[model samples]
Target: MCHAHFEDKYLCRNNRISNIAVPTLKMRSPLTPPSTTSLQQLNLGHGPSPSSLTATMQEAALPSTSETNVHLNLGEKTTVKKAKSRVFLTNTEKYLQDKLVAASIKLSKMKNRFKKLSVNVKAAKQIASNPAVCDILENCTSTRKLLISMQCQEDHKKEKERRFTLQEKIASLSIFKQSPKGYRFLRFFLFCLLSKH
Candidate 1:
């Protein structure tokens, strides 16, 4: 009886060891076995061999039952038509080429205009610096000064308008501050505003 019990225990231990070892043995390496079908699918430098092409043609010629029935039901028959290579350029391609040419012309014109503007600006600066040209410019300086003063007055007017707007905002805020809820709301709003800044 003791020998039978020891044999049962030994069998249980053997089963446990096998359960552990079997999984480790089954856990194969990440490197997989290469497949012949995958290798055949790969496109090497040259086109498919004559035999491969014939095999493909045979496969294509053999229609499925469903496809064959559909063709028959439609009163049509399967005919092997030679696949034609497509020539794709349309009107849009010609339009794009024309647009590209126009853009290049426009870019060249813009470059020329920029060069002309630079030359004119340089000449204007040099003329303004020369004593003879300075005398002529000085004669016109009074009119130019009037123009500058007019511009300054316009700027001042805009500044005053901006200041008035700011003052109105401040006055509105002061009026709101008198109310208890407004004061709390303003404080919360200011806190958020300051945190954002």
Candidate 2:
């Protein structure tokens, strides 16, 4: 019975070793014939170093802090520029306000002058329309009208003398023609001495 038990244990151990050895043999079979090119390609002497590849991956994964800082600085500069422009605009607005105030003052003065001129014109029109004022002006200017009438009479007398001279010349020419008799005959006899014809 001891021999029978020892034989069973030997068979179990053999089965376990075969099971373990089969996978180990399969796993070792591919590695046992080492391809020198494949080994050299994986080793440090043939390909890019692991340190440079890790650094490239790390740089790709991280965000750029300097680009964000530049954007922040640009934003601050724009804000400062805007503040300066606002100050300039405020100063210009104050200047315009002062100019507007001065212009308004001048406009008010012009309005007052127009009011005075309008009042004076209204008073003059009113006085001219009043019959009492008209009579007063006419009475005060009687001597001036008398002088104007005297000058008009002198002009009329000069016109009458020129007309009389023209009539006399016309009568002398008609007497020389002697081809008439009635009112013209009486006018010729009164103005001309008859010659025998």
Deviation from native of the Cα of residue 179 in model 1, angstroms: 76
Instruction: Report lDDT (Cα) of residue 10, candidate 1.
Output: 41
What clash pairs does model 1 have? Answer: none
Segments in model 1 whose C-alpha atoms lie over 4 Å from true places: 1-88, 140-197
For model 1, residues 1-197, the per-residue Cα lDDT tens digits are 22332333344443433222222223346788779777666644357866889999999989989998897866532232222334456799978988999999999999999999799789968866899966765677443544333343343344334222343345435545577576556435431111111
Q: State the lDDT at 168 in candidate 2.
A: 42
Query: What is the C-alpha local distance difference test score of candidate 1?
Result: 0.55
Pairs with backbone N, CA or C atoms under 3 Å apart (clashes), candidate 2:
none
lDDT of 2 by residue, 30-108 (tens): 5467788878677767677788899999999986999889999999999999988875448888999899999999999
Q: State each model's C-alpha RMSD to the native.
A: 28.2, 27.2
Model 2 — TM-score against the truth?
Answer: 0.24
